[model samples]
Target: MTLNRQWLLKARPHGMIGPDNFEYTETPIPQIGDGEVLVKNQYLSFDPTQRNWMVDRPGYLPPVGIGEVMRAGSVAEVVESKHPDFKPGEQVQTTGCWQDFAVVAPGQGPMGVNKLPPGVSPEMMLSILGITGMTAYFGLLDHGQPEDGETVLVSGAAGATGSVVGQIAKLKGCRTIGIAGGEKKCAWLTDVAKFDGAIDYKSEDVSERIGALCPNKWDIFFDNVAGPILEAALNHLNLYSRVVMCGGIANYNNIEPVPGPNNLMNIVTNRGRMQGFIILDYLPRAMEAIEALVGWVSAGDIVYEVDIQEGFDNIPSTLQRLYTGENFGKQLLRI
Candidate 1:
């Protein structure tokens, strides 16, 4: 019945976010109008995308305005409603961003979480059915364009999106090789996720390991962490290869500007095509992809991982984990 407590963005950050960047205060609960509903926030999504908002810059999405709650996807329950579309007891996954609660117009944005299948955890719907899964589905199949008997390479291969990319590549009959940050993550990719092979950038040489993994040269590259790794993949692409430009996790925290890839010429030399997508453009086909992903996951053909931290207050710290590659899978904040 009482509404309040919000974390507001006080100032933008220069590099790594600090506690002073946010100001926690009590706010009023807005009254729902004839077509609106009040939602009680339950979980918040912590993603690499938040880093883009730290600075006042232009990108695929607009930066979060100062004094607004940090922008994020959230799962909440509708506690009060005046709209016919939503009921009080229904739980929906809404954009809570960083606030504890929100007042939103009914039947807008993402899907409603009011109803869920029993035995299905929030991690499944939130991480796998949420944005991360969509990124993998559209980014891999539509952008990467895997072909039969081809070799596919994925950066940040242990991540939620990257992991899904590798599996989809395998399902398409491609040899999936993963490039992860550490030995532990690489082990998870090869052993748990059943990737064809794994590369540890921290210990092994990328060029040498990639050579051994796919001596024929990579045919499809699903890149999540760009920077040098992307250049490496470019240098090794097979003729007429497809390079899917997904997320650039590596560039999320650089204080200085990043230089262009040195091996970009490989695209010309190999006669390859490199394309980037934001997933939003393909939202109309998302449900069809979700259905396929669900079937794959349920059939043991696809594997997913989720690293969830409890509490709404942990959102800032949990998000920081994404930059460090400390999170092995999809990062989520529990409310």
Candidate 2:
């Protein structure tokens, strides 16, 4: 009785992605079997990781095969259900892909479908309360291990995850410094997120700016941009400092092998630690982070932004925004 519009990956990308990489199709809405719930997706979460999913590579999760539906996370409402745990009208989160609807089955592979909390809007759920928030929470607290009065540096600081990481660092009493691409975003970091300092990477010499701002050396380096930014931070690490390798968006689309950070020896010189983490590892304790984040949001200690693009037709083009650095915060497609 319904139609489902879907986007299928038509080809693997060599450089920047475009509409030609996908095949759009429409079919009857999927019917739910026993132990399954039919979801009418409300909001589609656009994340940089979705790019990796499109490639054929060895990674944390298997790559989406050719001609397969592109994978993505979304917030949805159960319109029909046969599962005991889910009921009609309940809002849930699942890997709804680039589609108008999804059939969520129980024990859905890692990041299984789950019910959302009460009273929180879908925007908040997809932004600060969802995977982006959890990534920031765990990446900073559990991995970075920031200390009070210490200096914390965050690359890609105006992004969804980076913004939250900077705020959490500030709330922990650390001096937070953000590295962004332009004057407006840098200003937002300093003026709005209240970062102790912001460096406009597009205009300033990263190494020089960081050397001046963190004269005492940095205690925690949240490396999201990686590459040259990671190298710049490496040149200024304090003894026993912690580096949280959250992401490397700078080279996610690179076809040729990108070289490692040039200042790799700094870790040994400063006797500091550098480690990477995948948020999926902390799924068992996600609610703890979610509750703390919720409390922070409720108390006005933490704030976030969402850059929403309308229509499912724009998913491919909209995703390119993350690569071009055109998206302001959490990028979401309003379905």
Candidate 3:
């Protein structure tokens, strides 16, 4: 009897996504005929891949087809149910897309989200427990593997994954240096996240500041914003250093391809290892990450910074903020 509002892709965006690229419509609520439970979405996640995946080309994941709901992962409360495993009032995580409601099957999605434990809010689940958290945990632990006394450099350090990556490095006894867009973000990174040092990319010479921050050379780099930042980090990479390339927000909106990194010579000189990572591969370790992440959150060792935008209709604008480096931290939608 209810209508579900879903944002469908209208046209593919070449550089940056905008409101015009989507078509929002009110459609009949999907019938939960068998094992499916209908959910009223409470929160949704916005990510950079929405841009990366829509190029009509093949990559690690498939592109979002025209007329399909703009793809997103969401946490919602079950409003109606036909499945015994999921009852009304229960919360779950599913591929909800940019919609006000969804009907998801049991034993589906990254993991069943029928119930969430206490102390983990919907924001925490979608962020720390979802893609952003996994990106930080797997990207740093698996690739960076920063050691005690090491100098760790994290680009986009004031945002979601970079904040956690720097904090995790700090917890492991490494000196964390952050690169963010402004002085405010830089201050938050050092003061709140406990990063040993930071660089405001807007006001300072990133490469020079990094050199001054750590004369020892950066031993591990968790790079979220690539392009020039990646180039800058290369100048300070230590011998056998590791670079975890998570996303390249700077180049996401470029009409032309970002020039090949200008500092490849440093990689050859330092014998550093540059690599890319995706959180999907680390799903099995979700519980392990939650246990550790929760401990940090409760102990005040880890801070969760979320930039929440209200309503499903605002998703496009919210998404554009990620590419502009305008969002201060973890980005999400409050449905």
Kindly list the per-residue Cα lDDT of model 2 for residues 46-131, writing each as its tens digit: 88888888889898999988888888899998999999999999999888888988898777855789898888888998899888
How well does candidate 1 match the true structure in TM-score terms?
0.94
Model 2 stretches with alpha carbons more than 4 Å out: none
RMSD of each: 1.9, 1.0, 1.5
Which 10-residue window of candidate 3 scores lowest in summed lDDT?
Answer: 106-115
Q: For every model shown, what is its TM-score relative to the native structure? A: 0.94, 0.98, 0.96
The CA lDDT of each predicted structure is 0.81, 0.90, 0.84
Ranking by TM-score: 2, 3, 1
Question: After best superposition, candidate 1 residue 246: deviation in angstroms?
Answer: 0.7
Residue 115 of model 3: what lDDT? 65
TM-score: model 2 vs. ground truth: 0.98
TM-score of 3: 0.96
Worst 10 residues of 1 by lDDT: 109-118
How does candidate 3 score on lDDT? Answer: 0.84
Candidate 1: stretches off by over 4 Å: 106-120
Model 2 scores a C-alpha lDDT of 0.90
Per-residue lDDT, model 3, residue 235, is: 83
Q: List the residue pairs that clash in candidate 2.
A: none
